[model samples]
Target: MVLQVSDSDPAKWNLALNNARNIQQDLGKGNVAVEIVAYGPGLGMLKRDSKVADRLAQALDNNVDAGVVHIMKRQREAWAYVRP
Candidate 1:
């Protein structure tokens, strides 16, 4: 499953992490893959200084794939053209 987070809000980061955890628990270890794609301001959630960085680290330890998309400008808007 893919969780797309476009905002830097801590709430969104927490929600995505929780969802990933839920899926992992439901699937019973290595049964499924979870990918978190963060762009725009959301990229901050993955930064070392961010409040949720620990949670992000935990998610990675749990086998969740986290990624950031770097764009020149209007990153959120760029999502509209990203295909699957």
Candidate 2:
């Protein structure tokens, strides 16, 4: 099962990512498929500029399907209120 968490808070985003990694780790000890997508403000967690990118990189390196979609300039302008 894939849990889709959509939130802007970095703390919550980090927690969710870690939780996903832990679950994937345990499940992979046996057999399971898992992935995580961080979009919107949550994308900040995986931002190319964020310090946490290394940790995110590590998770993705471990097979977590971590993905980030570039918010286009138009989308950024339209969603400026929600993005940091």
Candidate 3:
């Protein structure tokens, strides 16, 4: 499934994250691949003080070595500013 997030609203970020989580849960872990590519203003939502940090942190903690991957490498410069 392809999901796109384009705003910096915390609510929108949570929805996108929840949707992705739901899909991953529904399909069963490791049975499906889910990736999030944050770009434009949406990338700011992944910044140091965004509201989504805790959820993102939990996800990173759980999946770091699980072979599940995400984040956009399209614009390397912009990507350089975001940390898991």
Specify the highest-TM-score model's number: 1
lDDT of 3 by residue, 7-50 (tens): 78888878777877997899886886555555568767767788
The local distance difference test score of model 3 is: 0.60
User: What Cα-based lDDT does every candidate model obtain?
Assistant: 0.67, 0.53, 0.60
Which portions of model 3 miss their true places by more than 4 Å?
Answer: 61-84
Off by over 4 Å in 2: 61-84
**Which ranking of candidates, highest TM-score first?**
1, 3, 2
Predicted structure 3, TM vs. truth = 0.65
Model 1 ranges off by over 4 Å: 61-84
Query: Residue 24 CA error for candidate 1 (Å)?
Result: 0.7
> Once model 2 is optimally superposed onto the true structure by TM-score, how far is the C-alpha of residue 23 displaced, in angstroms?
1.0
lDDT per residue for candidate 1 within 1-84, as digits (tens), equals: 666778888987888888878878998657876666776678767789998988888777432233443322225544322212
Cα deviation in Å at residue 69, candidate 2?
12
Task: Estimate, for each residue in 1-84, the C-alpha lDDT of model 2 and write its tens digit.
Answer: 343445657566567667667766887735744445555566666666675677677766432333333234324445321221
Error of 3 at 40 (Å): 0.5
